[model samples]
Target: MTERVLVAYASKNGSTAGIATMIAEALREQGLAAEARAVGEVESVGPYDAVVLGGALYAGRWRREAVRFAWHHEADLTERPVWLFSSGPLDATAREGLIPPVPGVQRLVDRLKARGHVTFGGCLQDGAKGRIARMIVKSGRGGDFRDPEQIRLWARGVARELVKEVATP
Candidate 1:
């Protein structure tokens, strides 16, 4: 059976959501059935054979909705193939300094045996920030650091993994 994959994300400013959409599209292109949805809108993981959960990182943490979604669907996620991703790190060097998922997320990943946790560069647009974020941007720590090629490459890897899983059993 073809695996149905859910690409669910929690995005603050739509950057992560864009990534999720791209991933879903790439998966579809790879012949898997995939759909992208906001974590807040996903009612259940029961309908999907696999999941790709992503969140926008802020202050070393993931959005609350994404974290809660993982916790709420822990059992199902543990049984299915799951992947996790975080999008944030406005600094060009942020990828080099990528931090592991926060403790809570790591615990869930451990329990679920998630396939992987990838961190991609993020974008910071003009006038899209709150005061603090604006300050951070003004401090020369911001730009559109997102790399389309990198994101596409990661999605292709995910597609390959899903294909392997379908062929395994």
Candidate 2:
């Protein structure tokens, strides 16, 4: 059977969700069965052969929902192939180089034994939720920094790894 992959995310302002969707689409193009879903909406990870979990960043920290999901499904995630991603950094740095996971997320990566991790640029645009977000937008600091091509490329790399793993076994 084709690998069943789950591209799950914890997004606060919809940017991370968009990245997760791109990932799932790329995996499908690579002939794997993949779907993107919110971490809170998923009850179990047992159905997936592999997982790509992502979170948005705030104040140099991974979103709380993402952290909670990782720990909550620690047992199941460790038993399968897992990749982690973070979508933040409102700049081009993510596409330019590898941005290491934050301390909290690094702990999750270590505990889960995730196969790999990547950090992507984030988006903060008008009408974003939260007072802080509004302030950023008002201060002219909020803008969409997400690059779809970069996200797709990363997802394709992830697909290659997953395909290789499944083919080996």
Candidate 3:
């Protein structure tokens, strides 16, 4: 049977959502059926053969909804294959040199025993918004630092993993 994958994500400013969409599309291109949905709209995980959870990272944490969704559905998620990703660290310089896992992710790693966790460069725009948003945006950071080729490569790997899971048992 073909594998079914869910790319669920939580986004504050839409960049994370874009990444999720790209991943889903890339997976679909490989003949796997993948759907990109917001965390809130996902009513059940029963239908998916594998789950890919993604969210934006803010202040060293994933958005509350993403974490909450994982917590709420931990049992079901653990029974199957799971992967996690965070969109963050707009500064390319900040990305290099042995960065430690962010706090929320560190906690989640222990809880979910996630198959993998990855961080991709996100965007920070300066304008009228919350104080934190404004501050990060004004810090002279690059906008939309997502690497499409890298993302597609990762998504293809995920697709292969899901296919392997379907072949087993």
Candidate 4:
């Protein structure tokens, strides 16, 4: 039987959304029916057999909307299989170890009992935002920090897990 998966993301500058879309496509390739939607647009999680929530990190935090989405649906989410990912660490080597989420994000994680959280390197666009955002991007290396191969590998693992779940019962 095929499993239904929802890939939800909150993105600024489109980095996280791009990652979510690729992941959804990869899951489809693995024979799962998956859809990628923005966090705001998802009205209900009742239809999905599995959920993948992801967002871009800014100032070392996941986006506010993403956190709230998890919070709002915590009970439903906790009862189902869920995975989480974050596009973070603009600096290539900053994610060498397990970096715990800050207090706010920790609460979000606890609510869903998220199976796993992976931090991928994000991107910075030149002159895309106002003074402060521009300054932040310029202060860091301004380019796409995302590794497509790593993203694909991780999505494959998640898809496999979903398949395994379907096979179990």
Which one wins on lDDT? 2
Model 2 has how many clashing residue pairs?
Answer: 0
After superposition on all C-alphas, the RMSD of every candidate to the true structure, in Å, is 1.9, 0.9, 2.2, 1.8
TM-scores for all candidates: the values are: 0.89, 0.97, 0.89, 0.90
**Candidate of highest TM-score:** 2
Q: How far does residue 125 in candidate 2 sit from its true spot (Å)?
A: 0.7
lDDT of 1 by residue, 1-169 (tens): 8889999999977889988998998889889899999998989999998999998888888889998898899888998889999888886654565567767668767887998888888877766557876886788776787777777778889889888877886
lDDT of 3 by residue, 1-169 (tens): 7788899999988879988999999999988989999999999999988899998988788999999999998988988788888887786632543345587787876688878877877776755246877766677653767777777888999888887767788
lDDT of each: 0.85, 0.91, 0.83, 0.83
Q: After superposition, how far is residue 14 of candidate 2 from its true place, in Å?
A: 0.4
lDDT of 4 at 69: 92
lDDT of 2 by residue, 136-156 (tens): 888998888888888888889
The deviation in Å at residue 18 for candidate 4 is: 0.7
Estimate the overall C-alpha local distance difference test score of candidate 1. Answer: 0.85
- The full ranking of all candidates by TM-score, starting with the best, is 2, 4, 1, 3
For lDDT, candidate 2 versus 4, the one ahead is 2
- Model 3 — TM-score against the truth? 0.89
Query: What does candidate 4's lDDT look like per residue over 1-169, in tens digits?
Result: 7899999999978888988988999999999999999999999899999999998888778998998899888888988889988886776753455556666666677778988877877777875555756787778756687878788888999998988877887
